[model samples]
Target: MTNDENQELKRDKEILSHIQHRYDEEERRFQSVDTKISSMIGVLAVIFTIQASLFINILSNSKPDICLIVLFIFSLALYLISIYYFIKSHYFKKFSATPKPSFLMEEGAKKESEHTIVKDMIALYSDCINDNEKLIENKTNIAKKGFSFLIYGGCLSFIFLLCFLLELFV
Candidate 1:
């Protein structure tokens, strides 16, 4: 092959390589997000354990205040909402690319050239990016919801604990 033709092929290959690299990066990002969400779920479980223990301890008290009981119920509801969101956050689907369909082949079949390969690669990379974009948005939205719930739960629990402590000390 002529030097010019070889150079052209190399450049096309470089473009495809860059796209593949981006595709891989997006995949890694999705995995990282999934791992972080899983960790958050674990933390929420621990919070639930503490909440349960607190409820039992409070109930065992001989003179239980009705207001404190109401606070406990409110906090319990918040915890339930938080756990639901955390579980939902982990449920977003991961993007998995399938092999290029044979139907995508051009109607007029010709010898496979470097240009054709590069074109196909670019198309596949475009599809990959599109899929990843949706996945990222979905995961992010669900994560936000989960975090909001968690924060609300924490705030309610803190208020309850502060009031309960005041009751004991004063």
Candidate 2:
């Protein structure tokens, strides 16, 4: 092989290495975001379970009204914050887009296997990004629903408190 040919081969190797590095980086980012979202879900589930317990306790007590009202307000705040984190995490997952490789192989092209691998890597990255985008969109909708529920619950709790206060004082 000529010097020029050797230089081209080295350059191609470097390019391939760079692409692989980028792919690895993107995969790590994707996993990190997935982990965060999973953690958030677990936390929200725990919060919900605790709130349910609080509600049950308040209902079973003799002087339940005030306690229920206070607990509901606190739960509403927590729900709101959880929803915010949910949305933020969804956005992070959505916006972490990675560039796709664009090395096409023609007839009689050298390094066909390497080129094909790069193309496959690009396709994999594209698919992952698409899936993440869909997941984030769904999560965003769910978060909105959760926010609405929190608002309604808070209002109802406040109204209950008002009634209880009226009955007690007036």
Best by TM-score: 1
Q: Which runs of model 2 end up more than 4 angstroms from their true locations?
A: 59-170
TM-scores of the models, in the order given: 0.83, 0.47
lDDT of model number 1: 0.78
Which segments of model 1 are wrong by more than 4 Å?
A: 1-8, 98-111
Q: Pick the candidate with the highest lDDT.
A: 1
Provide the lDDT at 93 for model 2.
37
Q: Candidate 1: worst 10 consecutive residues by lDDT? A: 99-108
N/CA/C clash count, model 2: 0
Task: Encode model 1's per-residue lDDT on 48-100: one tens digit a residue.
Answer: 88888967787687466888788777877777787777678678776766334
Clashes of each: 0, 0
